[model samples]
Target: MGIFDKIKEKLSHEFIDIIEWLDYTDDTICHRFERYQNEIKNNAKLIVREGQTAVFINEGQLADVFKPGTYTLSTQNLPILTTLKGWKYGFDSPFKAEVYFVNTHLFTDEKWGTKNPITLNDERFGLVEIRAFGSYAFKINDAGKFIVDIVGTDNNFTNFEINEHLKSLIATRFTDTVGEAKLPIELYAANTTELSETCKEVMQPEFNSVGISLEKFFIENVSMPEDLKKEIFEYSRLDKIDLDKLTKFKTAKAIEAAATNEGGTAGAGMGMGMGFVLAQQMGGMMAPQMGGQQQAPMQQVNTMPPPMPQAIQYFYSANGQQAGPVAFEQLKALFANRTVNKDSLIWKQGMTNWSPLLEVEELKAFLGGNTPPPLPGS
Candidate 1:
């Protein structure tokens, strides 16, 4: 109650005797401990509660960092700050320096996503564009580095500022990782967890460079354009369809459609045509096995009669040896080239022995027109 005692009490209040941060907001990443004149008394109480770190900066230079403990700030405890301040010996007076309390707790559920589509080359789909989004968790690993690199002199730093930078880093690394993986585009959605792990591994060093520890990264979804999705779905559907069954189904449908037609002659003709096509398809499907298994035929049934037993191949004498079992057309070519003349002996499958080409019945019609009278013989 004396005037001197009251003055001492007032002076103590003026100089900050306790330095701490009781964060009430969820987003704050770092909060500067505020005092009346930014001064802390010698041997002041500094409380860095669990999930927090206390850092002191001297003249804009990082000096001391205390992790998750109670400390009385002095030259011994604040050696870096004391050295930076050139305090060779401890002083009793209040000191002027910046103290920042960094939140080191795991910040969970931070969202990251591709701001733009990432273009990649897919083996099956060719060039494709896709996008992905996910959540992650991070914590401040090095309070000193974080304060110096990110917080700087900002009295209030929040998750929003850090997230903006991190998201860009993640996006860049994600694009690179995905482009290099060379995985199928469809697989991205199927293997999000795997992809997420891969991306986290690739991006960890980048996060470490900024004093943030990436604890968890998750890929919630990978998406592509609607047209691309539809195309992929259609391709899958076609691959799974049975072509023979599909042909039978269509032929039945065609028959039903032809039967339902109302036009007179045109409708009859349509029905007949459909019936003919149906017969051919059914014949191919039910054909007797050539060996034991009936291999599926890919070609349509020939409407023309079986091609005249392959036009009767023949062998002819050429270069003093039998040359070929060539068809009639090839024989004509041989004669035109003078490699086979009327004296050239020829034989076919049914012939008992070789005969002169001129004597063959099949060649007379061709030779009568093409051959000239022999020069007058002696």
Candidate 2:
């Protein structure tokens, strides 16, 4: 044996005896062993525990990758390294190489979200501004690609380095996936299940480029601007109101009121009150369906009947003061309250002068063909 060999032999051996990465950290995604300036023995024992991948690199070139289990480092176990190492003797001699332990188990609770409002041109709600945030889980599926692309020379590759990159990918793909659905901003919050799955598919291509496979993805909450959220909240709460229950409660109270009066007058008053209530309900149901509109009637007078426009505005005068410039539906409410009449002095923007509501002709049906009984004798 040579002097160096004699020294190594005297010490029983002079090469890396065992290679492992037992000190794992929560923030670490990939960790490379420093090897303490020691060379790996040809037959070194490599222990890759579960949820870990062992990567061999030499001269900045990637070599063999090993999964869980103990590996005896040799030409047979590392063909790529053997080729790179140019092992003429079947990798029987000690060689220097880098070993990186990649975290292959699912890395979870990684969050992604839009930092700013994402604006989308929706089909139904027009332009909408929304924000969405969520979490995802992933794992390194290709240790070779991961080591060469991500962990190259990075002794402590961590999640912080790639967190923003993943979030950017999510934002870019998020806009496309959500915009494609064409859902209104109001409806986005309710579509989490579909959005999560669709977003995963949308982001899968870029994720693979980074050597990751999505294990589990989530779209926790999608929300709109604060004003829009409040409006939606109020609408949701109001939608739960039961009109039938209110009607029953009102009827019961009226019956109670009638019972307190004497001389059977309460009975007659109750009958009239019930009739009034029934009439109000009927008028409400038919106001729009019966085409009891004021503005359109005059327009069709000069031409054949026209299609109802999507919306209409009106102006009216009641109690000797002007009270409108309101929606067609709002003006119709005045009729239900016995306030609109033959001489109610209602006018629309196109009219030349304020005229009796009856002259509008479109609102004539609201009068029910009566003149208010001539006001009990003029």
TM-score quality measure for candidate 1:
0.65
Clashing pairs in 1: none
lDDT of candidates 1 onward, in order: 0.82, 0.75
Q: Candidate 2 on 299-360: residue-level lDDT in tens?
A: 34465678545344567776776664544434444565455666788888688998888788
lDDT string for model 1 (209-301, tens) is 878999999999999999999988866777787753443454456455755654788667656655655565555556665456867885987
Report residue 8 deviation for candidate 1 (angstroms): 5.0
In model 1, the number of clashes is 0
lDDT of model 1, residue 208: 90
Worst 10 residues of 1 by lDDT: 243-252
Superposed model 2: Cα runs more than 4 Å off = 1-14, 230-355, 358-378
Model 2 poorest ten-residue lDDT run? 243-252
Q: Estimate each model's TM-score.
A: 0.65, 0.62
lDDT against true structure, model 2: 0.75
Q: How far is candidate 1 from the true structure (C-alpha RMSD, Å)?
A: 13.1
